[model samples]
Target: MQNRPDLPHSAINPQLVWTGFMAMCVGMFMAILDVQVVATSLPTIQSALDIDPDQMSWIQTAYLIAEVVAIPLTGFLTRFLTMRWLFVTSLTLFVIASAGCATSSSFGGLVSWRVLQGFSGGTLIPSVFSAVFILFPKERQAVATTVAGVLAVLAPTVGPIVGGWLTETYSWHWLFLINVLPGIAAALVALRSLPREDINTSELRNLDGLSLVLMAVSLASLELALKEAPTSGWISVYIVTLLCLSTASGCAFVWRSLHRTRPLVDLDNFRDRNFLTGSILSFVLGIGLFGSVYLMPVFLAFVRGHNALEIGMTMLVTGTAQLVTAPIAVALEKRVDARLLSAAGFTVFAIGIAMSGFQDPRSDYDAMFWPQVVRGAAIMFCLLPPTRLALGRLSPDKVPDASGLFNLMRNLGGAIGIALIDTIIYTRSEPIGRTLLARLQAGDTDAATFIGVPLQAIADHKGALDQKTMAMLDPLLQTAATVQALNEAWIVMAVLTGCAILCLPFARPVAPAE
Candidate 1:
């Protein structure tokens, strides 16, 4: 057998290598897809389970909290179990948890299964990213990363539509059930195709119990705080306590990690210039990616009165454009400097997001089409370049930990970005609504026109609408205000994404693989 510099020495058969990797990608896709699928169909799930509206959020929140707690631990898990078994073990559990979720008859049971699903699913993401660098040589890394990156980003794009159709055409139970067969096949293929390795059970002895506790407490608290902060005032006592606990525990964990010879998570990876810059870009990209996906559905459903399926179909343009542009992105990534490609991606992405910010209350599919296309085309560019920038320069031994930290930033960015978006929508909507109402009362024809109430109607009413008419107009006023507030949130995402480009100057260019 001959060894080539462009392939890992262990990769004697490229076909088997790719098959194994793609199998892992399937697990990653299902894991990421579950989040979006469950999210869009929450109302349906809530109705079926008879869950209290306030507590219904726990369905998603539990998963998020558990997932956040698990993401950084992936580096240690990989080292302990080895990549082959780590992936198989996680995916197997994810499958079991999905089945549990599908069969649960109560809220508590559903949430319990979700926690397990989230924890197991969380490990799949970093494991796949780490494999890109570990399994392939630099010359082939871009293509490998593109395959993983597309699935990672694509899952979220397609999730809403898949979820909507499933829940509408079949039932909410199918959401979790859909993962079962694919998960089983992926697990089987990954087990057979991935290289076998010895698991180091001895790594268990060196694990810091207290540090693990602190890390779990820190991430869990932070996720909880973010989830509640948008609705509950950020300074509310419960939210403040959660923030304080998260900060205290997080600092202690970091301190312990830096001082240890072999820590569970390597916080020092951020000190690398390219890795740090790449991580920042990943974080901001999360804001735009998750935030944009979130904003469109809210607008379509709340303001436009579209159902889950309709909203999903409307959002499909972004996914379509992403698929269309993926090859072009891969081709460019191999030839262009990563930093330059990243700059161009972010610039176009910001323009795309900014375009959505100008929509009036009546904005629908036609209004949103180009923006989705622009953002979609830019998604691969956003994902592939920053990925290479972050992990491309790191040594193989350091890559697993670095991948965890790099991917962690993006998830954190999403958690925080959504919270920020919600806060904007919640806090600003009322004030704007009040202002709009006052204008309408003062016979402002523009205010009437904005909410789709005819100018003639307002003029005919002579600034003295009956109570019944005012009641009917109230919901319209609120919807219009929310639309305005949503536009404001879109601009915030655009600005945040645009500002990500500023960090590019700090990242050293990754030289082409020889």
Candidate 2:
């Protein structure tokens, strides 16, 4: 990251830096968008392939497992490869894999390509964060990171809109195919415009085998356990066994990493207090970000019968809020305390989520506006400072390792957040149904509305209610219970996000405005 006065000007010139940075942003947007895009089209894909529901989940799972497993390895790869090659290779591999996925004729073929795409996609993400600190000088980085922040926030929210249009207007195959042109363009730009750095051939020579195996196994097992925990029941033998394997392998990896002469990743980066606080914040942010995204889309599509495009449109408010906030965040970071900015951000975000926790069955996009705006506007301040806290202050040698771990923690939190939210809804559904039933049986007039039944109508047909009307009773009850469950999930997330505010005090202060 240190400037090399002897290097060619094209590598560090203002124009090249901006182009290279924009290319990385395109690559990042494509990679993140692909994850959520495919999610929206899963049913169409399953139907097109004639695969069973059980087997269909694996389409997503395979990609996720591969992605998570490759994320931590980016640190090791950085030792031998410059940022340019890393960007070029990842985009190339991702493009080829996307083509394969688009043309896949069988279930197995698609899954194989997805795994490759996922690994390549994983490498694209951390590279952007690495680029922020490496390619640009500290004087110029705030604007660069603001741009990255916009991509990071916008891509996930806009994914459904893009995916729905492509899938509905065309075919599910178009989802993967969409990445090809952008991927090629990004790779070419990065290869041509990005500055190169001298590689550490000696560090490359000491790549540890045992640690890689353990990390791969641990992360893969952990991802599987999280994915399956809700369906299998957290206490079921299948989930328990996988968790145990993950823990053991993870412990073994840490042990070997600490003892190795040159570990794949430098484990000592966690010793930095700023990095530690940043990582914890990253983990919590993941829960808030992924958890809300998962919950909102499901609520819209399932409870309200909204299409993917409609859901995407509703999510736009959040993105717009984030877009407006990015510049303010950039301008403020130079003058404000990082910890205070982060605390204010999380506090506002938590309040937004908590507001949504009170939504009823009648709530729609109109009802969702303010909360979405609050959460959206808060993302910049929340993410920017923590990122600065985590990698901004690290020595050039430690930035890679710290970046890897920082991003990895966020992904892990997301994996765990989705599973926990699913589990809570399942466990609460039946109990909430029972409680509603008790109130109805006891003749509580208000309880009748839980099933959309009028107290007067029930009284009018007390003994002569038709069989057709009775059939709807179960469906109505289930709907009511689900709405209640979603409310509870939002509340829990709000509390979790609110608690993140407490971590702000632990963060090392940002350097004062010059």
Candidate 3:
């Protein structure tokens, strides 16, 4: 195993390590929160900015694309920049970008700022993990992971609530502006507590610029293809061209990485069965994570007629549950076979997703609670143990590359999942909408009128429906349509989870450490 010369031993003081860990947690929270917080505020953004449906996705896409491009560079970047300096600089960039987002006067400006925010935010998770491992002893890695995990899980859960409250009570801008305070505080703490170390000038020169360009192009092109595939028609030339470009660049990335001495991604790591399996499982788990994240708020807002705040409060259950269960998951990983635990986690996740498929227009908030709790537990089971088991087998030298690759898979999976589910929803809703419209337009005497308006009138007035009228009848229609769409999506996710279950049989069982 190769030692990382850049890591200074003096940084491992218990109190300083604890302080730095807490600071990293703060940064991680802001990064993850910013990712999802905009979800609940999307409606507001759309309304205020008059963003087109096609372009609205770019709000999220901009962030995702930037993160995907930045993830693979973490290993190289750590070799040049000391972790303390990197942490402070990244946090500062994030804070400035957030402020820019809050103050942006146009949609284009907002998207631009979000891209900058994503660029800085992308370095956070890997950096946090690296800092924790470097600053704490091996035995305390679990505690560090727990702290980070809790923040990571809690961010998505609370994102909606926080974004909702800000969007509802104040304005959408506050969603971004709120980060400034925490960002500054985190940066200060990180700068003060995190130990500075020397850079590896030799490794610094090995940064693969061409590989980075190829990766960025590939991911960006793929994202565009996915976003446009549903609306642009699957056979559209733009989609085809983008897909081809993405495929070619992706192939080049792999070929170059494998054949080159100083490859950008170090493709050889995939030859490690543990790393390969872990990356695959991470990808699947990412589909579940991002898919549910995207689906839930859309469900609550469109189907249940809940305001953003209400939706946020509803999601709080999942976050709270994850916090409670994470420590237990770590304990279980220490005691039981991780392979079995991961399989059980996937099974539970599938069951929870399947339960989600059962929700109807009449389902109440209470009925939604247990499924979320189940998912929370499932996420802990799936994410924690598998992560431990996967990285546990790697030599320390390979850990950084393995971590980068693992995170990249998860991020890529998230992008693919969002694209798949969004496409499914768009495609499924059209025929259903058309059919429902036809029934409403039939003008049968027995047909139930919505808000005393004939079905035909309601369909025609979709674009012009007043808030008052929409408030009255939207829930029923949205509930029916959304439930069907979500059910189909969840079933697809369940199948993906099942694939993870099949892979679990191959997970190497580790004997307890003597």
Best by lDDT: 1
* Cα lDDT tens digits for candidate 3, 262-302: 78766787887766777788888888887887788878877
Scored by lDDT, model 3 comes in at 0.76
lDDT of each: 0.90, 0.85, 0.76
Question: Model 1: per-residue lDDT, tens digit, 1-514?
Answer: 0111244545457787789999999999999999999999999999999999999999999998888888898888888888889999999999999999999999999999999999999999999999888777677788889889889988988888899999989999999999999999999999988877778787788898888999999999999999899988999999999999999999999999999998889888889999999999999998999899889888988888898788888888988899889888888887898899999999999999999997778889999999999999999889899999999988777888888888889999999999999999999999999998889888998888888788887888888888988998988898889988999999999999999999999999787532
**Total backbone clashes of candidate 3, pairs 3 or more residues apart or in separate chains:** 1
Residues 1-514, candidate 2, lDDT per residue (tens digit)? 4322235334568888889889998998888899999999999999999988889988989899998987888777776676777778988999999999999988999999999999999878888888787777776777887898789878889988888999999999999999999999999998878876666677667878888999999999999999999989999999999999999999999999998877887778887888888998899898999888899998898888999999999998999999988889998888787788889988998988888887666678988999999999899988888888888888766776777788888889889889989998989989988887667656666768656777876676653546775676667777778888888999998899889878777777787322
Those runs of model 1 whose alpha carbons end farther than 4 Å from true positions after fitting are: 1-7, 461-469
What are the models' TM-scores? 0.96, 0.95, 0.88
Could you give me the TM-score of model 3 versus the true structure? Answer: 0.88
Order the candidates by TM-score, highest first.
Answer: 1, 2, 3
Cα shift from native, residue 352, model 3 (Å): 0.7
**Candidate 1, which ten residues in sequence have the lowest lDDT sum?**
1-10
lDDT for position 378 in model 2: 90
TM-score (C-alpha) between model 2 and the true structure:
0.95
Q: Report the number of the highest-TM-score candidate.
A: 1
